[model samples]
Every structure is written in structure tokens, then in C-alpha cells.
Target: MRVVSLVPSLTEAIAVSAPGALAGVTDWCTHPAGLAGVVRIGGTKNPDTAAIAALRPDLVIANEEENRQPDLDALRAAGLQVLVTEIRTLDQAFAELDRVLAGCGVRSRPDWLDAAEAAWADVTPDGPPVTAVVPVWRRPWMVLGRDTFAGDLLARLGVRNLYAGHAERYPRIPLDELNAARPDLVVLPDEPYRFTRDDGPEAFPGAPAALVDGRHLTWYGPSLAEAPRSLARALRAARR
Candidate 1:
């Protein structure tokens, strides 16, 4: 089955479960580098509908985090069968993988998933919970504190996620409230915000800051294997 995967994670998902079936992938979909030479279909938020239509794929894979609805609607209008996925938490990640397998008509599941789950089970945070601000943007700024998959992942690291209490995915907040949160660590993801710690004191005033790889903290699939180890190293180095 010829398929086009628009989401980044599903590039790996389709590669692992439905190899050779992936006819195209979004530009950001880079896990299975074998697809590096595949057709470049722009990014998740902005897709090239004309280019995609020419591919004549039997299926299309998209993600809620990546694609805007208007673009997806355009695809649907073009008679493309798009499968949009939403994996906001750890369990959802596993479930979404199975969903892809089912959609591909693949009968057997991968053994690596079980191993990934087993590895997750072994993560033991090394420190007392530290409050953190996870800003996704710079101008107005947004963070992941509550009700987010990232927050859940941070919880596994034994840190109290402040945004876990926020109402929106990336809420726009003032500088004062962020200061009032009294976070021990103000974190900036490598993407979305691209935070640098050298300017931490100047940026947030009182909070200790660290720039971290957002992929490990956010990407729940193959990239997750490195998260715990990296977090362990961060904790070991965290000043008391």
C-alpha cells in the first residue's frame, strides 16, 4: 500500500510497522533516515497539497500536533484518505502505534515496543520534585506544566510540572505569574523556543535555567530511549 506520512513520529511508525509502504514523508519526519532521500513534502503545519496529490498515495498519515485542520480539510477534499493521530501521553503513544499497525493491515506487533515499555518502567527519578517552567515560545512565551504529555513525562522524572496546572497546551502568560510560580528551573526546549542558559538570569531574572533537547522530553517513540538517561544526567548535575 502506497502511503504518505505527514507526521514526524509516524515516519518511524510506518517504517517500523509498514516499511516500503511509505511513499512520502513530511520534511520534519526524520527518524528513519533511509527516507532522507524521499520526496520532500514541506512541513506538518504547511503541507504542499498539490505536490501530495501528485504522489497518488493510497493513505496519508497526519498528527494533531503537526497539521492545521484547514490543510487537512484540503486533503480530504482532494479525496485523499488521511489518518490523523493524537498521542498526548505515554499510553496514547503505544495505542497510536497499534492504531497504525491496524490501519496498515499488519498482523504482528513489534517486540521493541514491549522493550520500550519495560525500559520506561525502570525509570526512577533521582531528586525531589523541582518546579519548572517549560516555555515553548519567546515573545509572549508558553510552557508545558499541566494536562500535557510533556508534563506526564516530567512527572516520571520526579519533578513537579507547573504547567500541568495550566488550561491550554501553550498558554500565553505574563512574566510576573511565571516568576510567582517560583520555579527552581526554567526550561527552554531546543525547538519552539530554542532557550539558552547563558542568558538565563537576564531572561527570567530569578530562576535557574537550562536549555534541553525537546525531542527526548516530547517525542514518545524511538527517541524516548534517551530521555531517562539524559534526565538522570541532568539530575546528577542539578545544583542543590
Candidate 2:
């Protein structure tokens, strides 16, 4: 079955499961590198519907949050089969993986999926929760807010998001307000915005900042297998 994957995590999962089945993928689908010759449809939020439909794919995989409704609607309007996924927690991540794989014609579960489940299954971090404001963007400072998969992932690592109860999923807050929160730490992810050693930490002089791999924290695919350990190391090194 021919498939076009708009979500980066789903792109990697499907590619890993059935290498050559992907006829098109979004430009941001960078994992499992060397996706040579794959047609680039555009970014997740603004996929080229015409280009996607032109590929004549039997199926297109998308996420409710990562993609826009109008784009998915246009694809459906053109008579294309679109599978939309929603993942807000680790359990939802696993279940969504199954749904995507099955939609893409992979009946058997991938070993990476099994490994990821095992990695997060018994995670019980010792200590009080580390309060953090995780910034995904720099300019104007957009942070991970309520009901986010990234926030949920951090919660598993004993890193509680300071803005997890905020109304917006991704909220833009003033730097002063974030600092005023007096969080124990500032968690910085490398994608959507690349927060480096010299870039994000200084803003929160009162707290240590942990620069982490956005893929591990945000993407729910093969990387899930190593996210617990990798995130743990970064959060640990951020200690004051």
C-alpha cells in the first residue's frame, strides 16, 4: 500500500516498519536519516495537499495536533484515505503506534515498539518532582503548557511542567513571568527551537536549565525506547 506520512514520528515508525512503502513525507520527517529520494510534501502544519494527492497514495497518516484540519479535509475531499492519530500519554503513544502500523499494512508489532513499552513500563523515578518551564521556542518564549505529550513525558521523569495547568497547549509567556515562577529547572528541547548550551540557560539565573533532545521528549516512535534513560541523564546533570 502506498502511504504519505505527514507526522515526523509516524514517518519514522512507518519507514522502519515498511521501508519503501512511503511515497511521500513531510520536510520535517528527519529521523531514521538518509530518506533519500522521498518526495517532500512540506511541513506538518502546512502540508501541500495537491502534492500529497498527486502522489496517489492509498493512505496518508497525520496527527490531530501536528496537522491542520483543512489540509486533512482537502485530502479527503480528493478521495484520499487519511488516518488521524491522537497521542497525549505513553499509553496512547503505544496504542497509536499500533493503529498507524496497521493502517500502513504492518500486522506485526515492530521490535522498537516493544522496547519502548518496556523502557517506560516500570519507570519510577526517586525524589520529589522537579518543577520546570519547558521552552520550545525562544523569541517571545513559547513553552509547553497543559495537555501536551511532551509535558506527560517529563512528568514520567519526575519533571513536572510549571505550566501544565495553563489553558493553552503552547503558551507564550514573558521571560519575567517564567522567572517569577521560580521553577527548580528550565527544560529546553532542541527542535521547533534549537536551545544550546549557551542559548537557553542564562535566562533562568535562579535555576539550572537542562538542554534535551526534542525528538526523545516529543516524538513517540523508536526513540521512546531510550527517552527515559536519555532524559534522566539530562535532567540529572541540570542539578544546581
Candidate 3:
């Protein structure tokens, strides 16, 4: 079936899950190098509905947390069947894909999930219960605090979130406040931050620091195939 995947993570998912079925993707959907030439439908939150419509897809895949409400309704109104997914945990991700594939009449999720789970199991889930801080944005600087997928993923790896004391999922935090909190690991995401190794080891000389790919940590869709490995890789890189 012809499909337009507006969700960025699903771009990776479509590569393994549905293969050539994707007709269009959001600008952020750049995982599979082959998608480089595909039409860019704008950002994840603001897709070009006209471009999506011109693709004439039989199905459009979106995420509840990723896309705005109007986008979902507008796509549906265009008479294209839409599949919306919301995932809070790994199980939820699998469940959603099950529905999505079923809706598309595919009857199975892409095989990457099985491999991901196996890879996740190989990690032994044996890691120090370190405290971590994940910065989402800069300038007024916000951070993921509690009940977020990053928080849960850290919990799974036996790491606890330092800012989880806050009520919001992502709380605005001052750099000084974070410094004082003394997290075992201070994380900077690629988005809203764009941290690079060139910034140097002495940048946060007091603690372990890492510049992580935000999508791998937070995207709970089929992209999870890479997540378990990415987390383990991140933790190992932290040793330096």
C-alpha cells in the first residue's frame, strides 16, 4: 500500500517494517540514506499537507505526541486513512505498530523490533544506578524531568533521572541549577542543543557528559531497533 510517514521515527521504521511502501516523509525522516531524495513534507509537527496530498498515499502514519491535532484531522479529512500511535513504553510501541500494520493490512510489525528486543536482552540490563540529566532545549533551557520516555529508558538501564523531582515531564532549568544538582551524567541532546564532541571533555569537567542522539532516546516507534544498542553505546562512551 502507498504510505506517507510524517513521523520521523517511522521513517526508520518504514525502512525495515514496510520497505518501499513509504511515498513521502517529514524533513526529519532522514535515517535511511535512500530517503534523502524523497519529498520533504516539512517538519514533524508542521508537515506540508499539500505535499502529502500530492503523494496520493493510501495511508498516513502519525504520532499523537509528535503531530499537532489539526494536522491529524486535516489529513483524515483529505480522505486518506490515517493511523495515529501513542507509545509510553516499549510494550506500547509494539502494540501501536501491531495496530498500524493491521490497519494497513500488513499483519505484522517490521522485524527490527524482535532484533531490538534480543539486542536489549543481550545488554544484561546491568549498569550502575547513576543519576542523569537530559536537556531538551537551550536559551530558556528546558529538560526532561519525570514520566518521560527518556526517564523510563534510563530506569530500564538502571539509571535514575536527577530532575525527576519536578512535576512536569520537561521542566525549565537553569544551567547553574543543574550544575549544583551534581548529576552523575549530564546529557545534551542533538536537537534544541546540537552538542558536539569538539566542545571538549573539560566543558563539564566536574562530571561525566555525553551528547546523545535525542531521537534514539525518545522515539518509541520501530526506531527502537537502534535504541537499545544506542543506549548501551552511550553508557560505554560515558566512561571516557
Candidate 4:
């Protein structure tokens, strides 16, 4: 069946599990290294609906948070089936992956999915509980707030989010305000905004800053299998 995936994580999942089933994907679907031939349907926020419709795909995979409602509505209005997923926790991610695969007509679970489930099945947060502020973008500085998959992932690792109770999922707080909160650590991932060693840590001054893989911190796909360990190591190392 032909598919057009707007979510990067879903694109990687579909491309890896059901290869060749994807006829179109957003330009940002970069994982698995070589998705070169698929039709480029622009970025996640601005997918080319006309181009996606032209692909005549049997399914279009998206995420509620990553995609805009108007675009999904337009796609449905144009007679395309779109599967929009909501994942705020690891368990939700596993369940959603199963549903997405089933919608694509795959009856059996992929090994990566099983591995991912197994990876996080018995996690114990290793160290003392630490409070953190996770910045996703720099310009106009936005941070992870309230119920979010990334925050949940960190929570699983014993890192509590400082703004997890905030109403907005991603709130644009000024840099000075974030620094004033004086979290035990500042977790910086390299996507949504590329926070590097020199770029993000300096802003935090004396606060411990953990530079982490954005995919491990945010994306919910096969990478979930290794994320728990990968992020834990980074967070632990940054303490020293």
C-alpha cells in the first residue's frame, strides 16, 4: 500500500519496517539514512497537500502535536485517509506504533518495536532526583512544559521537569527567566533548536548542562530502544 508520512518518527518506522510502502514523506524524514527517492512534501508544519494527494497514497501518518489541524482537515476534505497519533508517554508510543503498523496492514510486530519495548521495561532512575529545564529552541527561547513525551522520558530517568506543571506544552520563556529558575540541570537537545556545547551551556552559567541527542530525547521510534540508556549516560556524565 502506498503511504505518505508527515511525521519524521513515523516515516522512519514505516520506512524501516515496511520498506517501499512509502511513496511520499516530508523533507525532514532523515532517519534510516537514505530516503532519497520519496516525493518531498515540504516540512512537517507545511506539507504540500496537493503533492501528497497527487501521490494517491492509501495512508498518511501524522502526529497531533507535530501536525496542524487545518492541514489534516484539508487532507481529509480532499479524500485522503490520515492517521494522527497522540503519544505523551513511552507506553502510549508503543501502543501507537502497533496501531500505526496495523493500519498499514502489517500483522506481526517488528523486532525493533519489541526491542524498544524491552529496553524501557525495567528502567530504574540511577541517581538522585534532579530538577531540570529542557530547552527545545533558542530564539525567543521555548522550553518543554506540562505533559510532554520528552518530559516523561526524562522523568523516567529521574529528572523532573521544572515546568511540567505549566499550562503550555512548549512555553516561550525569556532566557533570563529560565536561568533565574536555577534548575539543577539544563537538558539541551540538538533539534527543534540545535543546542551545542558552546551555544546552550554558556547561557546556563554554573548550571549543569547535558547536551543530548534530540532523537533520543524526543523522537518515538526504534530509537526508543536505546534512548533510556543513552540519555541516562549523558545526564549522569554531565554531573561531573
Local distance difference test, per candidate?
0.75, 0.90, 0.73, 0.90
Model number with the top TM-score: 4
- Ranking, lDDT, top scorer first: 4, 2, 1, 3
- Per-candidate TM equals 0.89, 0.96, 0.85, 0.97
Candidate 2, residue 25: CA error in Å? 0.3
Off by over 4 Å in 3: 197-205, 221-223
lDDT of 2 by residue, 1-240 (tens): 999999999999999998888999999999889887789999999999999999999999999999999999999999999999999988899999999999899988899999999989878774678899898887788999999999998898898898999999999999788768888988988988988877655567667878899999999999999998888888888874
Rank by TM-score (best first): 4, 2, 1, 3
The TM-score of predicted model 3 comes to 0.85
Q: Tens digits of per-residue lDDT for model 1 on 1-240? A: 888888776777678766678778887886877774468789888889888888998888888877899988888999999888887888788788788767866678777667667777898877677777778776776677456777777778777777776677778878777657777877666875567775456446777665667777777666666677775566456444
Give me the overall lDDT of model 1.
Answer: 0.75
lDDT for residue 232 in candidate 4, whole number 0-100: 89
Residue pairs clashing, model 1? 145-163, 145-164, 146-163, 146-164, 146-165
Indicate the worst ten consecutive residues by lDDT in candidate 4: 197-206
Please state the error at residue 179 of candidate 4 in Å: 2.1
Write down the lDDT that model 4 would get: 0.90
For model 2, state the Cα shift of residue 215 in Å.
0.6
